[model samples]
Target: MQKVEKVTDKLPELGARFTLIIFLITIIMNWADKNLFSPKLNAILEDFGFAANETTPLGIIAALFMITTGIGMVIFGVIADRGQRKWITIICSFVYSILTILTYFTPNGIAGYWYLFFMRLVGGFGLGAVVPAIFSMIGDYASPDKRASTFSKFTVATIIGQMGGLALSSGFSEWRVGYLTVGLFEFVMAVLMIFIKEPKKGVSEEELHSVLVAGAEYQFKFKKEDIKILWNNKSNKWIILNFIDTIPGSMVAFVLFKYLDDYYNIKESDVLILMGVGILGGIFGAILFGYIGDQLFKKNKNARAIIAFFCNLAPVFSYMLLFLPLFNDLYVPDGVTFGELISYPEVQFLTIIVFISLFINQGNGPNWYSSVLDVNLPEHRSTMISVASFADLLGNALGPLIGSLVYQFISGRAAMITVAIFWFANSLFWIPVIRNIKADIENNKKILELRSNQLKPPDN
Candidate 1:
């Protein structure tokens, strides 16, 4: 490979800050767009002339959206790894933005359903690339020491985006208007991204050689075999963990509303409030646990894995508690009518448990992202994340099916217990990760060292 500048100057502070803002915007929009149709599903069905009896198309649409996005993440991850990340961000964002704007044109009746489905499938291809590209950029900007903390800070956008999506579902009068609003926000972001500059890969490596190495950079190209690196050896364990952990996690995402409605006999509107209480924990977890990971990682290289292990573990016990009468009794007062609980006059202790569990569960995310970044070279980080994302999406897609299957075979409570078991098993998968983290990080540093030295000036 031809030698290029080894380390480009870091972006101006303002530019770097704006880049993060753009990333947050893109993520928030991505999440909001995904959620746009769900809350308005009934309205959409009615508009398209689908009878109440014909509901299978809804599942088909959702499945297609997820499956296509998951596939796109892997494909675009490779391209982002090899190309200018800013360009990837711009193009992907543009595609989705345009698609969203066009949603208004979807025809009515069966044709409209297929039209929207195809549009969403294409839009997912664009939305899927946003995460890997932006995250990889964050890795380049953030030093290894601050990586987890940075990820945690950025994670707040994810929560806001997720919750914001829910709000938009009900906030708008028409689903098309909701789509247009999200699309407009996305288009503005894509335009702003035009001003951002791409960072030099591996600008944050700590080794002294990285400073000394001049005029050389790691040249990467797409290869079928490169995908193997994402799963071979050490990376495979985390990939598997993402898939396994998300299986139950998806239950929380997909089944929680219905479960709460059924268990409490509360209105769907009331459950949203409880769900919001738990989501607040995600914000707490991302910041607090992310800080812990960064601080500990400064001393112990395995801190990320350690943090992830505990975060995953704590949720297991907290989730299990939900099955007990004691858990419900804490929230449901003596002779308290369901209407009183719905009013939320007192703090819902069950929501607190959910808050704690969610806090702990979401806490693992930043550490996991940072750990993966630490173990891979800058050139490979996006691909690694994308691969993990693909697994995560796959697991989430499967999660509903698994939950439904379990619900059919056993009681709903038992099905939830199964989710807890999945979480427990998620913790178990981290053991090997703890053991291998140091070696993997070292291996990445060694590769950087080799590239750094390879471009040294020849002796005079």
Candidate 2:
């Protein structure tokens, strides 16, 4: 048995922390810009002379944005694995910002919708690269044990962006200003991206592995053949599970505002407040569950899957509260408008439930992200995540359409509850992962050892 040298030089801890912060802020800007239209959906359609009932166009545009985002992630994921992540992220961020700002320049009337649609479609391609590259960078910075917790912290930025977008769109009487604001912020962030140092791949493995096997070298470059390695891995099941799970998750993003305004009879302004509160829940959920995953993972490498299994079950029970007769009574009364019922106890109670449901709904993020990192090699991580992100985005792209079809056959309330079934099914898929997670971790360790042994000694 050969002894390994424990190198003292690691990526500076403060540098890693700063990198995460920058990535967090960048994503916040990206998501905020992308979702700026959510609260102002009706306002946007009104500008184009379409009735508020004409929501299919909105769904189509959102789906188009998501479709491009998915495709972009796959394309960029390949580049990130093989090329310079810093330049990829910088160029993409700049492009996305420029395109978003040009939303102010889209044509008017019926043509405006198509113009904005293609604008978002093109802009989403840039936005899509931001996430895959950021995740890939974080994979380099974060140790395998801390991947979920670090990723969860990063997700808090997304929740904040969601809230900020809703607030910006609804707060501005005119929706166009929201676009201007997000674009300006993104431009500032793109400039900031220029300063971020690209982290070396496999730094986490060198720094965080409990034991370094002598002569084990990490693979630095990824190849097209490695795609098969990602696909054949049993842990890739999480990729399919992400697809199943995000279908319902997308409805929460694209349909939640409409659902509250149209079905619950809540005013758009008030709905923003409710969504804001739910975002608070999401922040707490990501942090708390993320920490729990890190702790549990110290003992069980499969802990991410275990945490996800329970996280999936949680929303089922929480979302059911929305359907209870007691909960319904808390919504608008028969004679009372939402404005009048704002102070009612029942209304207040339902808002609290929304908070709980959202909290539980977000718990899946940390575990899922962490699990993906745990199973894949550093060289394959970006491509692996991008592949999963592609599936996740495709599901999200279809969510609004799926939600609409389900509503046609049932009450909107029932349709909302039915979304939980997908969550339940997503959890079931994790069961098989638990059985093989240990072996996968061990295999990864052995592969690292073999690769290290193949390297020639350094020249004096």
Candidate 3:
């Protein structure tokens, strides 16, 4: 029996250019997310004059958009695993973009709500297909040493997208501007994807079968087994880091924005500037973490997890700081027309609240997230990522519901604090995840390599 020579996962000579394209895709998708219904939310609410948190109808409408990303990704992940990325990427891009643009014409109040919902559902299906496919391509394209850094670029694009959405959605009091912005961007990106090519990998049915048997190929064989594998692998089991950290972040986030907007009495126009502060922080953090992650890769090759651990831990302090009235957050009330701190102490309070909020929230960036995706096996990359995405979307779906419940039972500071407590409890989940970061990365590589070879052609 002849031993197969191993292939190095180094960047192709044109790797920099390829990475740039991936970055653009990340930004576009994020823009689609940020702009979708958020900017129009307040306007829609005003138009409907519905009580706050009574947004069940729109929530359901918007949430339908996320469903496909969660449920659909699992199926498409399997498809990408089978090495059908070429067509999947192109088509999904088209679907996601067209649906996003359709958002512009959505009728306002109730009618507008349904339009956004329907388009989101279509976009979700398209989005469902692309993520895993991209990861699979990146897995093959990037060398292990530089992979984390490469993936960080994607995360940066995501941040840019969120920021873009922040700007687009918040740009107009009318919501049409946001819809147009997201729609045009998605359509343009879809058209641009025409020239980008990721050569088919393990492109044949036999090779596909070999990869699945070896755990490299996609499978239709959904079982308790798929999730079981997520927990069964000793190294993989620790991934609760992904699940644990993002929950707190997502749960109170929308409310926190409201809290800040209310705190500083910030107008719609300032929200972008307010959020932009965090985006700037993310840009700095990405550069810092990318540098650190690359260095750690040289020393330990599992730097992605280490960066995640540190990034996850940073929010703990930030969350607590917001709970403060004097020591941390100190923003003023929205409509107080008195002296700065004399006639209105609330404004002073709000000012402090936002400053800290900006400081603490900046931690949500590529520094914390891209590492997890970068380290997973390429074939299983989408599904593994979907695990994190699933946890997030699941939590994203659940968190706001809890916030609604809290608002019903409590009011003002108490309602805010109740959500904060729930957020803090999840911080405990990251500890186990971070402790074994190095082990998970190393084990994943070993497992995938041994299994991946089986997916390779006998000649290669």
Score candidate 2 by lDDT: 0.75
Clashing pairs in 2: 215-452, 215-453, 216-452, 217-452, 330-346
RMSD of each: 4.6, 3.5, 6.0
> lDDT by residue for model 3 over 1-460, one digit each (tens)?
2222222222334453764584366555654474435545456666655666464555555445556666666677776655566567767777776776676676756665566667777777777677666665664544455555656676667667766766766666666667666656666766655556653342222223234323343323334455665565554555634454444444454454555555555555555555565666665566557667767767764455556555655555654554554533455566643343334454444444444543343333443444554445455556666566655666656555555455445643554676556556654555665566666666655664554454533333
Better of 1 and 2 by TM-score: 2
Worst 10 residues of 3 by lDDT: 1-10
lDDT score for residue 104 of model 3: 63
**lDDT tens digits by residue: candidate 2, 1-460:** 3222222234434465666677888878766765676777778888888877676777788888988998999899888888888889889988988888888887658999888988889998998888888888787766676778888887788788878887888898988788778888778877877776776566567432322222223446788788678767887865455577877777766667777766767777777876777789889998888888888988988887877877777777777677667755444535655467667766677788878877876767888888877788877777878888888888878877676555545656655776777767777777877777778888887887665556543443
The reply for model 3, stretches above 4 Å from the true place, is 1-19, 199-231, 301-303, 327-375, 412-415, 435-440, 444-460
Candidate 1 positional error at 32, Å: 2.6
TM-score of each: 0.86, 0.90, 0.78
For residue 326, model 1's alpha carbon misses the true position, in angstroms, by 6.1
Report the C-alpha lDDT of model 1 over 281-388, residue by residue, as the tens digit.
989999999999989987999999999999888888877767666546333444655468755633365777788898988888889889888888777778878888
- Assess each prediction's global lDDT (C-alpha) against the native: 0.74, 0.75, 0.55
Candidate with maximal lDDT = 2
Which residue window of length 10 is worst by lDDT in model 2?
A: 207-216
lDDT of model 3 at position 88: 75
